[model samples]
Target: MSDPATSPERHPDAHLIQQAEVPPLDVDGVQAASVGTGVFAVATVIMAVGYDTLAAAGDGWWLGVGISGFGLGLISLVYTNDRRRRRRRGEKLSA
Candidate 1:
């Protein structure tokens, strides 16, 4: 006899699951990166303004953190924009 757990009768929805086809989602990475970069830029500005207060409060590193995040977000924005452009032109994206 077949194992009960492995038996076809064990799952009534197996056929439905096998026949289901999920469509791929179309996302705009450039837009997402732009939003992220904007947020980071705002944070960097806030941190810069509060640098003196933060240093006095022993949170001086927050300014650097904000700057780094803003920098990385900018990089991501550039990369995503390039990727979107390449995709639109039907170019093969580098892995």
Candidate 2:
């Protein structure tokens, strides 16, 4: 006379997992940005050598270019990490 099927509102495992609770935000970006800086350092050295030979520029000038590139790359990395942090924190990015 009645429907034979029934659905459980919530599973036991799911309830337990929810009760445990987790940290709010993840710090993956902080770690990755640090590594990226190291990579950019090496890349700058390589670019310096290349420019020195290709343009016949002096060591000082090439060194300056390499240092500048390295700084730019690092700044970019930091900005990227800030964006990631905002995303993980559930904050909406501004349009």
Candidate 3:
């Protein structure tokens, strides 16, 4: 077998880009966290704005909305931290 370093990167039998054709995005974790956080933030806003209307139906909506806001805030913090971590990781990798 030929050594990988001497071979062209593409796999000969690949119907599409093979697994070896690409490397993982090192910042994918941060990107995913940011996306999740954004979704949660939107949910928080929806709950906060409509909580009273929802609560009028006697469905414990206030508590649920409050929890949603708190959870979103917490996740936002985590997302921010992950971004910083990703930047640092990138720096390390590049260096």
TM-scores for every predicted model: 0.72, 0.43, 0.44
Q: List the pairs of residues colliding in candidate 1.
A: none
Stretches > 4 Å off in candidate 2 = 1-40, 46-59
- Per-residue C-alpha lDDT of model 3 across residues 1-95, encoded as one tens digit per residue: 98764579857665553457677774436565566667666766777677787778875566565576568667766866766777767754333
TM-score of 2: 0.43
The global C-alpha lDDT for each of the candidates, from Candidate 1 onward, is 0.82, 0.67, 0.65
Q: How close is candidate 1 to the true structure, as a TM-score?
A: 0.72
Candidate 2 residue lDDT tens string, 47-83: 7668757466455565666677679768868787888
After TM-score superposition, what is the CA distance of residue 77 in candidate 3 from its true location, in Å? Answer: 5.5
Which ten-residue region of model 3 has the weakest summed lDDT? 26-35
Better of 1 and 3 by lDDT: 1
Decoy 3 TM-score against native = 0.44
Global Cα lDDT for candidate 2? 0.67
Q: Summarize candidate 1's per-residue lDDT along 1-95 as a digit string, tens digits.
A: 88766786788555434555877453548777887888989988988988899999999999888889889998988888888888998999877
Number of the candidate with higher TM-score, 1 or 2: 1
